[model samples]
Target: MPKLTIVAFDGTKFELDVASGSTVMENAVKNSVPGVEAECGGACACATCHVYIDDSWSEKVGAPDVMEEDMLDFAYEQKPTSRLSCQVKMTDDLDGLVVHVPERQA
Candidate 1:
């Protein structure tokens, strides 16, 4: 399992133990972390799971693909490091991954 640190717009931090191979959205929903709505589940069709990858983890998480990039346009306050949590899979290498949830989702 890999650990993830999810930071909320209000600066709350949730340290979660997430299962490998699961998406960040899955972990958030399962743990009831606020700001991650995941309205379409893990599907890339929605932007409710939007989040900002921590600067330190940006390169590791990489850039979003074309479809994901398009979807992100629908998110609130998008940033260079913005990513749809549903598209971010968990792995051992992301053990200390950190993401910031915006004040609101699209």
Candidate 2:
């Protein structure tokens, strides 16, 4: 399992133990981590699961693929690091992954 550190817009922080191979959105919704709506249930059809990957971990997380890039266009407060959580699969290398939840989703 990998640990995910999420920071909410209001500054709340949550550390969740995520199972490998799961998507970040899945764990967020399952754990009730506020701000991740996951409106499409990890289908990548919505930007409700939008998040900003921490600067320190950005390279490791890598850039989003074409589909994810197109989907992020609908996310609120989109940034260079913005990513759809549903497209971020958990793995051992991402044990300390940190993401910031925006004040609102699209």
Candidate 3:
């Protein structure tokens, strides 16, 4: 399992043990972490699972796909580092990963 550090816009942080092959959105949603709505489940249909990849771990997570890239444009507070958490699958290289949630999602 990989450990994920999720931080809210207000500075709240949650450390979750995520299973390999599961999406980051799954871990956040299952643990009731605030700011990750995951409204469309893990299907990538919604941008509620938006997150900002920590600069240090950005290279490990890589860039988002075309679909994910397009969807991010719809997220609140879109940024150069914005990504949909549902699209980020957990992996060994992502151990101790940190992501920041945005202020809003609709």
Candidate 4:
């Protein structure tokens, strides 16, 4: 398992021990992390699960694919590190990964 940190808009942080094969959205929703609505249930059909990858982990987290990029256009306050949590699968290499939820979803 790897550690995942999700920072809410109010600066609250939810620290979780995540299974490598699970998606960020899955863990966030399962743990009741604030701000990760996951309205589309990890289907990538919406932007409610939007988050900003911490600058330090951006390189390893990598870029969003074409579909995710398109959906992000609807996210609130999107940024350079913006990504859809549903599309970010957990992995050992991403241990200690951190992401920031926006003030609001799309």
Candidate 5:
């Protein structure tokens, strides 16, 4: 299992022990973490699950693919580290990943 930290817009942190191959949006939706709307249900059809990758873990998580990158353009407060949580698959290499939910969805 890997540790995933999701910081809500209001600064609350939901620390989760996630299985490899699970997605950040899945865990957040499962645990009821606020601010991660996940409206598309991990289908990458929407930008409601947008989040910012923490600087420290950005390199390991890598950049979003072309599709996700295109979707992120609709995310609120999009930035250099913006990513769609659904597209971020958990793996052993990303054992300690951190993401921050934006104040609102697209």
Candidate 6:
């Protein structure tokens, strides 16, 4: 299993131990981490799962796909590092990954 550290914009953080091969959105929603609505249930159709990868972990996560990239344009407070959590699959190498949720999702 790998652990993920999710931080809210207000500085709140929650660390979750998730199984490998699960999506970040799945872990966040399962753990009830704040700000990860996952409105489309990891379908990549909605950008409610938008989050910012921490600078230290950004390179590890890499970029979003074309569909995810297009949906992010509809997210609130979008940034260059913005990514849809549902698009991020957890891997062994992602242990201790850190992501920040924005204040608003819609």
Off by over 4 Å in 3: none
Candidate lDDT (C-alpha), each: 0.95, 0.94, 0.90, 0.94, 0.93, 0.91
Model 1 agreement with the true structure over 1-106: per-residue lDDT tens digits: 8999999889989999888999999988988898999999888999999999999999999999999999999999999999999999999999999999999999
Give one digit per residue, the lDDT tens place, for model 6 in 16-87.
Answer: 888999988998898888889999999999889999998898888998889988999999999888999998
lDDT winner between candidates 3 and 4: 4
| Candidate 1 similarity to native, TM-score | 0.97
Model 6: lowest-lDDT 10 consecutive positions:
8-17
Considering only N, C-alpha and C atoms within 3 Å, which residue pairs clash in candidate 3? Answer: none
**lDDT by residue (tens digit), candidate 5, 1-106:** 9999999999999999999999999999999999889888999999999999999998888999999988998999999999999999999888889999999999
Poorest lDDT segment (10 consecutive residues) of candidate 1: 26-35
Where is model 4 more than 4 Å wrong at Cα? none
lDDT of 4 at 1: 92
Give each model a TM-score. 0.97, 0.97, 0.95, 0.97, 0.97, 0.95
RMSD of each: 0.7, 0.7, 0.9, 0.7, 0.7, 0.9
Top lDDT: which candidate number? 1
* Candidate 1 Cα lDDT to native: 0.95
